[model samples]
Target: MNTNLSNDNEFENDAESRIETEVSSEVESTPEESGAEENLIEENISTSETAVSPTSAEITTPIEDNEAAGEVKEVKTASAATSNNQGMSAMAKGLAVIAVILAIGAGLVFWKMKVGTHGESLNRVTAEDMQIILKDANPMQLKALAESPEQKKKISENIAQLLAVASQARKDGLADEPIVKQELENIRAVVTASIYDQEINKDKGPMPQFGYISEDQVKEFWNDTSHEAEFQKFIDSKLTLARESGKFPKDKELTEEELKQAKDDFAKIMIYAEEAKEKGRDLGEDFNREVELQVKLQQAQFLAGRYAQKVLADKVKVTDEDVAKYIAEHPEYDTKEKKAKAEQILSRAKAGEDFAKLANEFSQDPGNKSPSGELQGGIYKDVPKGQMMPAFEQAALALESGQIADNLVETPYGYHIIKLEKKGEGKDANGQPTQTYDVRHILITTTVKDPTNPMGREIPVTESVKAKLAEEKQKQVLDEIVANNPVEVAEDFTVPQPSQEDLQQMQQQMQQQMPSRMQPPPAGDIEPPNSQEPKKPQPRQ
Candidate 1:
């Protein structure tokens, strides 16, 4: 197998090129040769159980834990999710980024084994073998990706690449580690059960051969006292982690129905796993290696998430007192005084003064100012209806072109003196008719600018302070982890840096590959005072 990791786009293009070349060549083959190839592919369909894709595993849903409260939730400050004051939680974003990094590292191993051409010739693994691997790796995508010889050849090569890394892991004694061994077993059980679920769920006839788990089975599992205790311990640990990571509410508790459902789920998993073992699937070296590679990747993600959560809770905790101190120190962020200043600015604007000039001189919104402190006159052109704060947009929309709002508009940020410079009709991105406007505003901000952030959004004083502290703590924690576990790559291990275009393409691929739950939330219309304008895709709700 050739060992080279190229950009994902390159990978796809190469595969397509190969498929086209193979299809053209096959057109000239004899009828006997074609029939044999078809039979080969069909025969390998049963071996799909050994398929694997290191980067394709979805995040496991966390079962509720019932442990007592920990110190992590004490002093209850704002969530780290809102640390950036952006709609998306910063902590969740960080976790997703870490997941991406871990996935990439796992991918690096497989990519190292990727041969530029069809790898079957080198390994003596035919196209049918590759088909089975691809089918099992992504059962949902099997028909579309594995029907053709060239497709199977390329996709199977990917699965084969992962085997090399898993083999290396076994040779290095990694597979023998206690934690790894346990995790591998758990993963195998879950995957085996999932495959069984798919098989039984197939619409074979009016009456299926395999029926759903009965209530008796669920009860039987729960009736075991030891099983109940084990489940409790497992759930408690999961709940504790969920609460600490802010993924669940502090008071989250399990209910009878939920417990019963969990038992039923586990019963199915265990039964299917046992069945698979009895059928000799567990003894397959290829299947074991595929699972080993997945386990390795999953373990890395779990450790990183746990370590980052601990660092945030233990070392970078932010309290309300910290925010209060920051608010008190920054007099410019005083709400009462800022409100008064906004009224003054409103009066000046209504008194026939140059609105842009007043905005340039008085608006506290840093987005309207240049790095050299040059005023931009607070002008926002081609603004969408739903893109500004409710009060700000309401006041702007109520006025006619060349008119200003009669009263100062108040929002969480502070006060806005809005002037409608232009109002017009336009088609939105979806080609639907929508209202677009150009507006100018002078803002008197109640919040302070984040000194450490380049975009300079008007985050609350407390959030700014917390963000700073958390950032410092994260840096410290990461530094210590690196120092303790030193690593140096071999001189022969070098990967060429991707170009900017490659990076953008890679980002798109990652976004597509990322689970829907982990993706960032949509942007809200109510943008902060100093942040960039919101996108104009919809009208104000």
Candidate 2:
């Protein structure tokens, strides 16, 4: 947080200090308003919903919208779970630096600058001036800071960064804003005070929570062992960001000489970082109480989360009996019966009639009518689960390539007099199993929604209600799981809200991140790229 220091062993080298900024940016907690926490949560929400999947390999299994082809891509893109108030809270109001864990990143270190107490020829910020700047430089505090000659000399060299922050704020259209100027002054003041506090008092109160986060309980739900691909993907993202941001050299890879220098810097950082961490853990009675509260709260949330998954996922079943019982209990569960009126078509196909020819002549799939009097049969090629209704999928799966069902398979859409053209087993690039079913079916549309009916429509048969029944039962099961697990927080703990100006500045900083937001924050947890409508759609497949 304290950006400037001179003649210090920990960050004596300018380049080392600049590199340290990357680690500093890795705070575990920021107030609810922080951009860093928001981004992290966005990336990790899928970690929860797919309790079966790791946060790393969030697979896409989209349910196609029959209304429009475009909606299929939209649903797949937005499949990640929402995480506004999940796992742990993000509010990390701190006296200084919001909240940073000693663990910066993989192989990175924390630099502890021993200042004020050391008797060396170096610049510093006076204790008095720091307080004045932080607390809006009151008349009395300003008068006292000016009168202290020794204190003034200590701060002469390091105060420029504070001035620069002010200058940057003005250039960004915040100069005329009195509240914005004061908030900037306050953040700088806190940073300066924290430095002096560390220098003068090694009594850092109590031992704070370990590494700012405990991953043990989270591991209970996310036990997937396949992460080698994820690790490489993570490394690739870092490398790409470096090139895109110009944070590292513009070349694709570091030069030999550059790599050597970086290695040496990394070595020095590791040594000093360990020392800083050791000192912080044993820094007397001034332990970070906020961190302790956050750790405890997170532990409790993880416990509840694990329990919910066990009950909802591990215990719940989707057997045929479950659906039957649900329908019996709630008459509304059985959607209008839709029977594929394909007795004549099935008989013709079984009587040595060409199945493809029969499908082209009799299939009633919507939007498949041809102007030339030729039937354009709608075909499902290399179909996966959830792309088609459960009954249709199961019936097709039971048949081998080139096999046709003797009886009609009923689904909510109607019925499928089906034929399996092909079946293949394969793995995607990420090494997950991919079952491809090239299925040919002539759908007979036998049901339509009607406002006149009590259940909002009328269907012809009970066998056709599989899809809607399955979806409703799944929701009911999840609702039951949440109802069973009671997650409670410490009643006494409360997070303070930010003021108008503070919230505005936080919002501004978030917008400045890559793909700068062109519009306001979304009502939902997910933030779309740049604007409500993305500039361009990048295909995930």
Winning candidate number (TM-score): 1
What lDDT is reached at residue 463 by model 2? 26
Work out the TM-score per prediction: 0.39, 0.32
For candidate 1, give the lDDT of residue 403: 98
Off by over 4 Å in 1: 1-99, 102-226, 239-255, 274-282, 312-441, 444-476, 486-532, 535-541
Off by over 4 Å in 2: 1-289, 309-319, 329-337, 340-376, 380-405, 410-414, 419-440, 444-496, 499-541
lDDT of 2 by residue, 163-279 (tens): 222223233344244432332222222222233234334454332211121344224313534433432333343334333223334444644554444334333323333344456
Q: Residue-wise lDDT of candidate 1 within 208-243, one digit each (tens)? A: 112355567756766767766654543454444434
